[model samples]
Target chain A: MVDMISMPDDSTTAVDRALDAVLTRLAERAIPRGAAALALIRAASDATTGGKRFRPALVVAAFDAFDGDRGATPGLWDVAAAFELLHTAFVIHDDLIDRDIERRGVPNVGGTFRSRARSLGVADDGADRIGDAAAVLAGDILLYEAARLVAVADIAADQRVPLFGLLDDAVLVSAIGELADVEQAVVPGEPETTQLLSTAHDKTAVYSFCAPLAAGAVLAGADAGDRAVLMTVGADLGLAFQLVDDLIGTFGSEAQAGRDAGADLREAKRTPLISLARETSAWPQVSSALALAPTGPIAVRAAQRELHESGARDRLVALIGQTLASVRRRATELPTEPRALIERLATGIEGRIP
Target chain B: MVDMISMPDDSTTAVDRALDAVLTRLAERAIPRGAAALALIRAASDATTGGKRFRPALVVAAFDAFDGDRGATPGLWDVAAAFELLHTAFVIHDDLIDRDIERRGVPNVGGTFRSRARSLGVADDGADRIGDAAAVLAGDILLYEAARLVAVADIAADQRVPLFGLLDDAVLVSAIGELADVEQAVVPGEPETTQLLSTAHDKTAVYSFCAPLAAGAVLAGADAGDRAVLMTVGADLGLAFQLVDDLIGTFGSEAQAGRDAGADLREAKRTPLISLARETSAWPQVSSALALAPTGPIAVRAAQRELHESGARDRLVALIGQTLASVRRRATELPTEPRALIERLATGIEGRIP
Candidate 1:
């Protein structure tokens, strides 16, 4: 396992400082807009905290691999922080779409506002409505803030357009992926494996991995060939990361995943694991267990057990291993430092326990 | 009344061409992403159509005020089109927040997706959920597209930052305004007049009026003093426009308003008119009528009658007039062309039938 705690302390500190500066600037801007405005900013600030800072780490790592001077090129931190903010915005919207009130075992932006409304004597439905509205607005402000950070990053004038273009493309692709994911859930059917993988790539990989790594390359004035190599490596690592996440989400403890382990089944989310399990000898047992009120602990556990016993889990594990190997192979095109960082990140994703 | 039909033909054509180019570029970009992405781009395209193009008109007008040569400075049209896109984005989110499926008497983005889901046999709740997710994604894409247009516009490099800064400020202020507006409706007490007005200014004025004008000024390389004057004028005009909209929303025929006339009453929205009506002798009658299931036509009519008879309607009209007068006074400081355009826009807003 590539321990997350082993990330270089300076990069982490730089990202944290960049984030703090962004939030402080936002707070300063909101001071004159009144308390309601400030409250929304606070919600955004809270939502941004507590993530593992993985995306920003990729940015910093790529920048470092190019020998970009951290002190002289502080805007790289802002670029890194922009990715974090974008992730927070996506998380807020995703939670709203999923009707999830809590994230990371705490009240999310929507949950925070919902509680506030309920404490003020609002009814359940009314509070939920207020909460949804707050979440939408909160997500919106963060989204703009993210874009604003990129637009205003003190980089070489010629580099600004590419950075903005990359950010815009990431936003567009992510939204498309999210739409596809939601459509898969609503349209009753087994989504094609290819379709599901495409959704996963668009929904998570483009923004979380590809953009951040490529953005760092852009900042470092790396040639197109190197940037393309980084993006390909980023995509492979991102796919591996998401596959692990699905594994953890389905079979890991709540403490391991920081969310309910049974949520994917309860939601009837058409994940690759569920799809792969359909092809196995234990399909009947897994399907029956899932059909029997999947929200219940017994049903969830039965399905989990059947999937584990079916060899589908092993198949997925093999698939992830293959993906990581591909990433490692591709990282050979890069210099030593970035290649090592990519391999470590892939290893860390592979080591996630379920 | 400034006739919408009488907008300068050249400017209107320029704005239309700019919007078309933007939509085409988006479509081309989505070609490789497959059917789902193209569908989203189509929905965003649909949402952008059929509005008055009022915001873009302001951009063109402000640009024209400085003799910004349309033939040489075509980016002015992109700037104008960005405002329209921003407006469409806001409208999509607003409809989602209001839970309205239709906008301007047609199926909105959510409604279109909801209908599609139902046609595919999804249950009502499932369809609504799908619809909401689609709307959220659709709005997000348009919002980013707006910012992207601003970022990529072929203006002077020095001019780019100010335009971006204005766009960011407008987005931030508008979100704060929207949150405050939602809070007013959710909270139990009558909202203070000052709070309501602030919400009106923040929610509607900043993006719809101030930013578009300021952005145009930035594009023209106008002096800060002129830009500031135009912003003040835009604020006054936006306030007048919203106040008139509220009047039409409550008192105009459905045909005139292009939406259900009774929606605000049914929603029990705390508009300035409602707040002012609370202080009048008609409060008892209005309260009773509203207490009797405000969704019904009889109750809505009774409440409307009380508001009209209590002179609150006239008070709001007078407020609109005062606002228009202020806009005219401020516009006097601008160059002749912009002054005329601002005054005409305000007059058109005031002339809406009720």
Candidate 2:
């Protein structure tokens, strides 16, 4: 059903441009469904497009890799969209759960809704309540719309059947992971790093990377074995990606972090770096240094040193090296060099640790 | 594409019964994809089937009235399932918003989720919070899944083009109505009867009856003129139906009510009778009576007397009677007699108030 000849060749530059046009059209068509949907889509797109375009790029790359036609089926666009929808849903609800203010230089959906309600003369308690409720619904709708779009995709029925199931599995796994995250938040913690990593794999790796990558591969008519290879590559890369992200959130500048400095620190999120820091006894001194920072790069440097001495930095570099080697090893099993591409992205993302 | 000649006659009892079987089966297939869809689907079926089967009946009745063959494509089951799904979503979210405990003589989704979390050793506040979150997501899945099911129906693609759009419109309206209702809850003073009725009409009338009925008509190949009639009849019937339900809730015995005697009173919901009582300046006494002895036939008799003297009962009765007449009038437009059956059901439902 996905004829390779349908895709635009590398010489044709308009395919990427055409995607923007189609996305705008989709947005326009989606808005009239209702005011609430319009508001939500607007908010979601703000954060969605603000991030790195890695996910969408994967759809294009995988298609190209498999010699699958980029223009073959518009279904590829819908699949990419499905990924954004699920990802945006997570980000919105995650921001709400975490009580975040700014994300990627934009107010989180919860904060925006709350501010809007207040400007309309709603009381603070009621505003907060309404904001939470609206955010929940918005996330649900975004996720729903993504699935709906996939269902309504004008692809072969056989191909479409598995899309929703994959999506459903991703949603369930992510939801359970969120539950675990929520539970961890309330517990008087010092939870094991393994438990936390498992949560990351379920909520982050599987949904964020494996599902979308495998979806793209399947769209390109990748064989079962190819899909299996992509799955492993995706999970490994995604986990590494999250670890890097968590590292940047703590050690990087606010601009680079796209979050408050020491965010996971404040929330006491059980990121791998945090666990490693604690396991090596760097946490005690690092934690004390965080509380006693002098509000400059000097404080940041000192904390970094404490972290390194605790073996957190060394372990991270070692893990990345190991993961990179694994990716190099695994790519031999599949064509298209997706493993290489994922590693490249992982490398760029993890570079923030310095 | 909705081939009629291939359809079994609605007059064939076995054909109609088999259609129900199909609809039931469709509702039962939650998701092979994962636990969340399965959780949501199970919750939907449990909550949906436990009701009076009124909404589904309206859809079936409307379809059969046009001589629309249920077996025409077997996909009519999708339409039936969609209606129930929407209803289930609305009720689940509505109960959570309203903080009601019982729906159909069992704990609503929020209550069930909360109880389950509590049993799992989650803290009370944490459990309630998680329950709210889960219920929100679950309700959304039901609404989205309903639309998904509708799109899957093998209807004439041209006629069904706007089916999901229409459902989306209904969903947005219902959610806004929810927002408005929640906003209106603390307004203290009684709203005008017209204002209260308008709010009630948008939130409950269309959401509960008109929209579902209209959607069913769309599925059955009803013309615009036919749909207008259906909506009108459905809206009026919905209002009257809710009024009767309010009365029963306010005054019925424990066995008869199967719900709290003064649930509306406690919640300070804007029901017609309550609004009427307020406007007539008889609310202080009646409200106190409602508070003191909102149980048994004596209360129903007292409320009835108060409603009568205030001219409220007569007005409501006249309106309901007119609406029922319109339903009768519209029945003639149907290609079959299921319209008459629906009309009779409406009458029976409305007449049970005393």
DockQ per candidate: 0.65, 0.22
Give candidate 2 misplaced runs (Cα > 4 Å).
A1-54, A70-72, A99-107, A119-121, A281-305, A337-340, A352-354, B1-79, B99-124, B140-163, B187-195, B204-232, B251-257, B276-308, B352-354
The numbered model that scores best in DockQ is 1
Report RMSD for candidate 1: 2.6
Model 1 misplaced regions, further than 4 Å: A1-7, A260-268, A291-302, B1-7, B260-268, B286-305
Docking class of 1: medium
TM-score of chain A of 2: 0.83
lDDT of 2 by residue, A185-267 (tens): 55455657777676666667777767777777778787889878777877777667666666776676777666667555555
DockQ for candidate 1, please give it: 0.65
Model 1: per-residue Cα lDDT at residue A307? 84
| B188: Cα error in model 2, Å | 7.3
Per-residue lDDT tens digits of candidate 2, residues B133-179?
Answer: 55665565566556666656667665455566556546655655565
**Clash pairs (backbone) in predicted model 1:** none
> Which 10-residue window of candidate 1 chain B scores lowest in summed lDDT?
B1-10
lDDT on C-alpha atoms for all candidate structures: 0.82, 0.62
Give candidate 1's error at residue B98 in angstroms: 0.8
Clashes of each: 0, 3
